[model samples]
Target: MHDMAQAGLTKYVAEFVAAATPQDLPDDVIALGKKSILDGIGLALSGSVAQSGDLVRRHLDELGLMPGAATVIGAGRKVAPRFAAFANGVGIHADDYDDTQLAVASDRVYGLLTHPTAPALPAALAVGELVGASGREVMLAYHLGVEVECKIAEAIAPRHYQTGFHATATCGTFAAASAAASLLRFDAKTTARALSIAGSQSAGLRENFGTMTKPFHAGRASESGVAAAQFAAHGWTATDKILEAPRGFFQAAGGGYDENAIRGRLGAPWTFADPGISIKPHPSGSLTHPGMTEMARLIRENDIKSADVKRVRVGTNSNMPNALIHHNPHDELQAKFSMEFCMAILLLDGKAGLGEFTDATTQRADVKAMIDKVDFVIDEKAEKAGYHKMTTIIDVTLNDGRVIHGEADFGKGSPANPMSYEEVADKFRDNAAHARLGRSAADEVVALVRDLERQPSLERLMSLVAKAG
Candidate 1:
């Protein structure tokens, strides 16, 4: 094991990235990496139609520069690798629909981790395509990036998240840089410089959660990461100890560094294989998923009508309220973070898919009426129990004096109750169809992703994404 204490956190991560190989990744880890890639592609495809995604795409087009550098995921256009990463990263996270890193939930102070794939995959794909990297190389880069990002998140979270820093943007920048550096085949010294530069550029605020800027954070992180790696490969200089110095990342952004948490465990258990990543069943805030699942079940099992319910009560972890900040959401973006909106939509529509969280749907009289009737109550016990083991209890009161109760310990897409491969494929197809991608094209993407490690180059995959229907 590398001596992280002596090496410093940034150097340790860079060395790990430099040493990572396809052989170092276990079979299950490789499979998980592929799954995460597929999930991210699906989300990006669906998000391509989002107003925010469209805006970024148009903005990039207006520049009229950097042709043939990399392919945009769903637009059949080419831009610089950094621009491609930025645009695709936005699309992947536009609806908050990407996978979440579950290991960060272990932190006592905060329950959220960076959405690992949003930035890492974009950076990997953009750089991979730019350099004609093979599928095995791309997958290796992605795995290395996730390892570095999740470890850093584990070492500094709760404090990082509690301080209103968006981990997906802050930690994700390093994740992107690591993936880019790996694909570019940078040595440890160059990779460390990239990480150090990334540390200085890392930034995003939770205050932007409900706006388009939230997804933009992921985009900016991806862009900054590609730039950092490109600069570092050309002899850019930065402090070698950017993550552990007195005024470094953990000290300035995080309350303090937890050296013990980061060191001596580079890949001891493989974070992706242990706590794993949660592919979201709903496109909204992940913390609200369990409640959405139970509410949908209760409404279905009891044949509850929207008008029959006088009021609805939901109980979740105390910290969830702060995360789901929009109580009475007026827009689609806000609706995704609003527990009331999510619950109302699930009960009103029977399912909460990408189509449900929209401005038109959120502003509907029936949906608003239901949203008004729903109330969220923080379960002190659940909060104390911690987010990783959190549960949801939902109670519904009918106008006729009857009550319905339901509880869910884990969301459908969580590791405790994981979505089957078939389900994940179904989700991908649904997302693609929503984006108007042809059925044949969507199936080809799925097949290619499943057998990704065998491809000689990402050219075919990028071509398929570019040719989206």
Candidate 2:
């Protein structure tokens, strides 16, 4: 640990990844980590049924890419570990429903830090299965990957996201590499080089939001992690000071970064316990959740109908307009990022689940009319709440000219208002059923994950969840 005191950011991170062991996992971490992993699997299974996810699966089938021993979730087959990671990553994020890293700083916007589980968990599962790792080892690898990814995200300047980069894909490349290297027991030097290799591989654009390409960023990042670790294991060369170097990742990608966010902060507080993470209650963008929550609340408490609500106004800071770009969505993919669509659906159905995001739902006359009645604006009041909070103010005006005010700073599954474990289980069952997994299989998957750290291996767990009957 003392060695990290004098090491550069990259070297410190590499050493942290190299030395992680499941034996020292705290009780709290074990509990949250298992739930996070379980949640990732559920989202992946549910997302696999999506058109984007099916396309990725079909592409891999077409290539018949190198046959290896790695399970592709919902695909009922094994492929190369890298390819499997890619497929699973796409599946996990296909609906934009994966768990998100919480924002730590005021300038850091919610939902932009990264989707902590998407890239990291898929890499851990693919690599762990390839190497026949124990269940604890795989879970530990996943936690380590998330830790490094979050720290890097914190260290980077907020402008990185504001300037059109998708942090989940860019930061996630490093996360996947960290997980793969940790699972493989790469030495410190190899770990450092793997991270360095990942820096070059890091890529994702904000411009790709509202399309299948956005999820593809998560897939590519996961696959790139596998490729980088494999490359580093074979003595691939790269600068050891990838993070702190003048022209290295921090400066090249983000212009500048904060060293304090990295130094001695790798696992000292553990990312999950401090800034914490949010499990999404909705499949849409995190930015849209608060508004949806407020709208749903106003409707439910007031017993108002969609037709009775003559006008609605949703206001947030300027950052939201850039992230939620789909003003009018034509399909489920775009609906995930459309504030207008999200609120309209919640107003109409009281909830927006996987079943409500179809293209048909988006084009319904009532839905379209509701969408037209809502306005998204940048408000000074929301800006006053600061960027760290996803502060959303909702103003609903009824046809009778009665005005109702509602606001939500934290969405349903936020740390301030967490979901119970049973709720998470219900979510898992719903998603698993959507993917066509039998109820018995879904129950077993939950049981397996509940005691994941004690399981002998990933064999039974992955078998139940990854492959169809």
Candidate 3:
């Protein structure tokens, strides 16, 4: 074990985690915690029956792991905390419909933060349930986990992502470990040790983005976190200075480090409160959201038909195109990352939703024809404006010589254009229905999450999440 003086970045985070209490959280932060948790659970419910979720569930069954206290979301089963975390984590991100952290997008040079809740919430819920933690305890741990993960993402961002690392799986491991440690009520030393172990286990690559492996990254991160914390609780040793050492995580995984970004403010004003969370309005990449919303709006308001448009041009930041890597997607998974596919669907159907991205829909001749006419270009001005505030410009040229243009500075569901609680609940209901979970159980989950802090335990909430089918 390293001395506290030599503990470096790990010590700072561990100390904060050890010292923080539910009383330290502001009302709004607590509220945001509940909101983020609800969104993650909703996504997990929808993803439970997805291809990736089914794959992992089958793998776990093959392993024949012993049952534990934690429930696997929408699977109607119990498993060990680590397995449960892995399954639920995969489920949350399986559809690529979870929340995104755009707080660091303004740096232009740095990549965006990972989806903050995907790994953290699963770790919190699994551990919280295993330990019989209260709703407030789970919320507190969840908030701390996001805080640690996002701060690290800010510290070593664009480099971390540009280097082919998946931030959700890499940074997310630490987030999950931090929350699990909190749920386990670890001391500062143990928490720091767990984080150190987490750094060693962190692994995920962006090259797998368009496949089932993408969601698997989240699952492994969640699993690693529980394992790290559990191992630390049993007195496993690790380098407490793992985050700041010359050969540590940032040095090896990130292009470079911004010490100040990690060390600064330490929660003077919460990241969630400032940049906040962007609940998705669409199921595609967050960067493509502004353009998708605007395109749909333009088509609907102008009464444009598929045959009316000659071509569509979309302009966004340079980095925006990187996430939308699938230029000619042939599958549903690939279509989520294909700006052309998303744009084609919007122009042809006047909307893009969960049902719009599918193998059958993507292969349709009309969709293919529309995809051929959609063009994506990096706007120099928009790229110069930076990614912190994502912007999009759309210009549609009609065969009739009519041109229509629209611009969006922020996407719907952003903090600037927030979704109401009712809207979020509706999304949850729809996702639950898609998974064949009964409406009554879905409604109960929504109600329980809204009043999460008041719940005596997470038992009722977890029970409601079990798949009806």
- The per-model lDDT (C-alpha) reads 0.85, 0.86, 0.85
Looking at candidate 1, what is the lDDT of residue 181? 95
Candidate 2: tens digits of C-alpha lDDT, residues 33-87: 8778888899889878888877887798799677677888887878998998999
TM-score of each: 0.92, 0.92, 0.93
lDDT of 1 at 261: 71
Better of 1 and 2 by lDDT: 2
Error of 3 at 274 (Å): 1.7
What's the distance in Å from true for residue 63, model 2? 3.0
Ranked candidates, highest lDDT first: 2, 1, 3
How displaced is residue 460 in candidate 2, in Å? 1.0
> What TM-score does structure 1 among the candidates reach?
0.92
